[model samples]
Target: MIGRIRGMFILGLCSASALAAGTGYQPPFHPDQLKGPPAGRPNEVLVLGSPHLSGMPDTFAPAQLEPLLERLAAWKPEAIAVEAVSGLQCDYMRRNPARYADSVSSYCVDTGPAQAATGLDVPAANAEAERLLAQWPATPSAAQRRRLAAVWLAAGERNSAVVQWLRLPAEQRIAADGMTDALVAFLDKRLQRRDESVLVAATLAARLGLERVWAVDDHTADSPTPKEVEKAAADAITKAWDNPYSKARAAADIPLYANVAQPDGLLAIYRAYNAPESAMQTYRSDFGAALVEPSPQAFGRNYVGYWETRNLRMVANIRDVVGQTPGMRLLAIVGASHKPYYEAYLNLMHDVQLVDAEDVLR
Candidate 1:
């Protein structure tokens, strides 16, 4: 039976032209191919898979990240994208709280203080940020950076605000321009957060002389489960995760997280996470198990569907920026689980070339 199924799949590939003749359902083109002979510059994307620093083992020192940061700095990415939802999306979600209340509460920065300070709401502040950046000077004044930082904060993008703030010299990072004392305090607080978005992406961007980091994470796929099915869905999925593959997954990763404070331990952690087999392991453990879940409500399939939908939208957001400026070296930092999906989806872009994460880490 397996041999027969494999033969049928092979025949489907050979039957691509059959679809044009209206005789088969096979797809005619694979987007992963069709790379051009020449372009101004290929859009090279290097995705770094990372553990959430906020959840790292207690032994993990924030200073231990310096070596990893230095290595990535050497890659010279022109643009950096972090796993964060944009302010615009958050603003929209906030207005429709019935569907997004949980997401807003969990992932979004409360921009109220910054909005009051700037007298601009989310959309206005985000637009003003774009306008200022459009013609940002070769050498901006300290006040200019401070003002941009304020605008970014009002837009619900604290990481980008941190980028702007960090670019300024310590003495100049003061309450001027639109930066009120409270807003300044907000950004100062962000610098101390151990989350990957701040500790890694924002810090790296500032060191690389970039003015702003991009927030491309999506929570639009997130919605409260219907009350009727919520508990059953949760129980079913939890049971599915209590499997052998999942146990092995934890076994392999627990040690990696524990030793990150040691010399070269981070590089080891990265290489293991970015290994070619890591994606398959994720499938065998998480999504794949969820997919085959036998619940009558099809809870596992729903879980898998959500995962794919989230990754699809996340990749689409990344593509939006990659399309705007072709031929630039871009870096995307995301959770380890998202790396494979990001790469698979990005490879479908006609112009994007995926740089091996292992190579970058090496």
Candidate 2:
């Protein structure tokens, strides 16, 4: 709670002025003040804001993430969530290409082969994956793990599939239990990519002996915009972002990204990214700037709306996972740009106790 605010049970309506600055009215109640079921342990969530690994410099090596990973491993999160669209959402978007065609191409994996191998589409595969895990043994054989991987892949949860693949013994990584040869090859190749979900989240899950990583990212807010409107929105936002704060952020990031492969370099970058001041810096540079851009169509408002909607849905997806099990510990890995919004919005939940990212990184 170093930088977080706890809800106040008392409303200060009696004495002092709670008057307006612009349109000020302090609410009568705080949901966070309402708290839990009054029984079991409260849910703890640690949101780790990560730089998208796919955007790292050419010199970036997966091994460089070790120090950062070690600290998170010590945290011992029971459930891990990553910033990737769930296969279920991807399937819905795929059907309506008029709106989400581009998003699908950018965010979703092609699960056709795995679907064919498992004879299950995204929903069916997700169901089967749940069924198998419901009856999953305390100690499963290699074939069981392999089948789970195949099933997860078909479910559009490739990162979770990677977790299953890593858990299997080296010799046990074969096509068995509905795992086709082509699917195994696909998993092997995809496993080698430098995605944070793979190298960090899934890797940590495997080390912790967890069954799978959660895909809690969302793009359902996306809708097709006309070409002309897209250009106008992009230009307006770009102009807003040309501020001193944005420039300063770029200046700091250049050095951090440059030194990431050096000893303990990755740790420094994460510390800087997770600092409390960084959130304000983000607002000043990005969202805050965009909020005031005087676009005729209110394009700035549209962009901000899309961003908030997307984050809200993503957090809801996470809430779904943590809700199923009381007192669960969840670690969410998302882009640094998303950190502030995630923490601020999640703070409103009654049962949630937000863990300081700074403390965890420390």
After the best TM-score superposition of candidate 1, give how far the Cα of residue 143 lies from its true spot, in angstroms: 0.5
Model 1 Cα lDDT, one tens digit per residue, 130-217? 9999999999989899999999999988899999988999888788888988888878888888888888899999999898889998
Error of 1 at 324 (Å): 0.8
Of the candidates shown, which would achieve the greatest lDDT relative to the real structure? 2
- Whole-model lDDT, model 2: 0.84
User: Local distance difference test, per candidate?
Assistant: 0.83, 0.84
Candidate 1 to truth, TM: 0.91
Off by over 4 Å in 2: 1-21
